[model samples]
Target: MASLELKIEAKAKQLGLGPIGIIKPQAMEGYIHRLFERMLRVPNGEKLHRGFLELFDVRQAYPWAKSIVVTYADNSIYYLPNVARKHFGKFFLTDNRYNINAPARKMIASLTAFMEGLGIRTSWNEHPGVTGLRWAAQEAGLGIIRRNNFFFSRRAGSYVSLTGWVTDTDMELRSTHKEEPCPEDCSLCIEACPTGSLSAPFTMNMATCISCANSYTDSTAIDDHKLNVLTGSWLYGCDNCQDACPFNQITGYSTEIDFPGLMELDHYLYPEIIADLDYEDINDFIRPKFFYIKSESLWRWRLNAINVLINTGSSDCTRILKKLLKDPFEIVRRRAQNALELLGS
Candidate 1:
């Protein structure tokens, strides 16, 4: 008969996951404490600290949860082509819309169903919860925490999506201490950051991060300088740090067939497309998988499109900016006015 760990690993592989790791729920205390201390110094850190306490209390919801199983699916290579063509060739819009949470959710759902069939009880944690998934992944021997504050698996680099669950089933925990994979002197990701968000090794100022600044539902929080610093290319997510990593450059390709291929230039945002886009076009074509923004927040997307057009510095974009001057969303109109100023129109 197979051990419970072996059975779980088999089930994970069958679901198209990259790796599986296990740890005792009680063993996560040290990692949680360190994270809590770090979270205390950031903006809105108090609220985050409180949230972390609730989420990291492994025994709070499932007192019977003796063990935790951590799993990650490869994503570094999953969207490389689209990202490359977008940044280097100025081709398509490279958003993480396709492969963000969908794959991990599917894998977790399948694993839960399989575990239930074997009469084992389980509970999964969604994102923004107290699971400390990246830290938990480090403790489970799945990866190391790199200087950019992302989990780096030797096999998957920094492009892995993590999912975790607590269970009543007891499993052997892997060693918590593993040699760090990053070189002591490497600062590639840090040097690539446009906003200096990477304050130090493994430290990030979330408020200024391009990924957070652009996608944040509150468009008013970001001022003009930060918006310009986001660069004109990225629409939804930023990959400057990851793209600059030597590790990612070498091991970023995946064998997954379901991933989308390199999108053509036409698939990206252009002056013509931005001029014609409306609410229906945004809902049907622009929204990525697992859409989170509200109807009122659609202006953020429009603002991003306007920024991209401004980056082109084409006189052609002046007309589009003019059309957007009367947009109902005050935020959109303000940005269009900014674009016109940038274009000297």
Candidate 2:
């Protein structure tokens, strides 16, 4: 069994997935339950469940589940936007094209097949799954949850995506290595947060997060201050916190796997191009990769773009804002009107 586990670990590393470890499902129950309870207490905490602990009743999903194989793929934040802009001439947020979720899913599928070939039954989960990835990864000793509320591995910083597989096979469990990856004196990420989302050390107020505000499907749900915070050139997700982390400066891009979709940047929409977009353009070009924004939430993108223009304070944006004043979506029209007011045009 030890030899087989070694083989599996080597195979995973060969497949460009690693910092792998194993843990018993029972070990995670208490931590997950506590985390779930806390999540329910926060505003918009209901939405956090899918990524945190909603579907992840390990005993229920994997009745025979004995161990979870937690694995992470190197997703250095440097390569993501840099490669997209170099190839596609535009910056990309953490969408399908640049985010590690897509590659993590691919790794899970491949790992499942590999385990099945060795006569082991395996089930895997990604974002909205029966496994809470961050907790599981931390339990498996792959990383530590830092003060910024992101998983930070010694080798990968916070620039990796997590995935896991559950199986009936009783593998040797990795010892839990509880770590405080953050330096005691450094609070750069907390200070850099524009919306005061990082309320304290290792705490996050998700409702106030600029990234959450940018991704909100309903533009009306966000107030003016949140809107202003998001207006600072962010169209989808905010990287201010990550950018401030000193540990993230270490290079992990060398080990990053060149996944297929990383180069597919046609879906990335820029601020200068938003005023010219119609429903057809969005449906045909942007909808496929940026699916998280949703078809009904198309106005959010327009609002983000308008906010970007407003933040730039470019007089040239007046023409674009005027065009968007007649936009079919009420949210776009209203945001555009407000943007014009800010522009004093």
lDDT of 2 by residue, 35-91 (tens): 766565566666754465544567776799988888776666334445233222112
TM-score of each: 0.84, 0.84
Give per-model CA RMSD: 3.9, 4.0
TM-score of candidate 1 versus the correct structure, residues matched by position: 0.84
Off by more than 4 A, model 1: 40-44, 47-50, 77-105, 175-180, 254-275, 288-290, 312-315
Root mean square deviation (Cα) for candidate 1: 3.9
Candidate 1 positional error at 32, Å: 2.7
lDDT of each: 0.67, 0.67
Model 2: colliding residue pairs: none
Worst 10 contiguous positions by lDDT, candidate 1: 87-96
Whole-model lDDT, model 2: 0.67
**Candidate 2 total steric clashes:** 0
Badly placed stretches (over 4 Å) of model 2 are 33-51, 81-105, 175-180, 218-220, 252-268
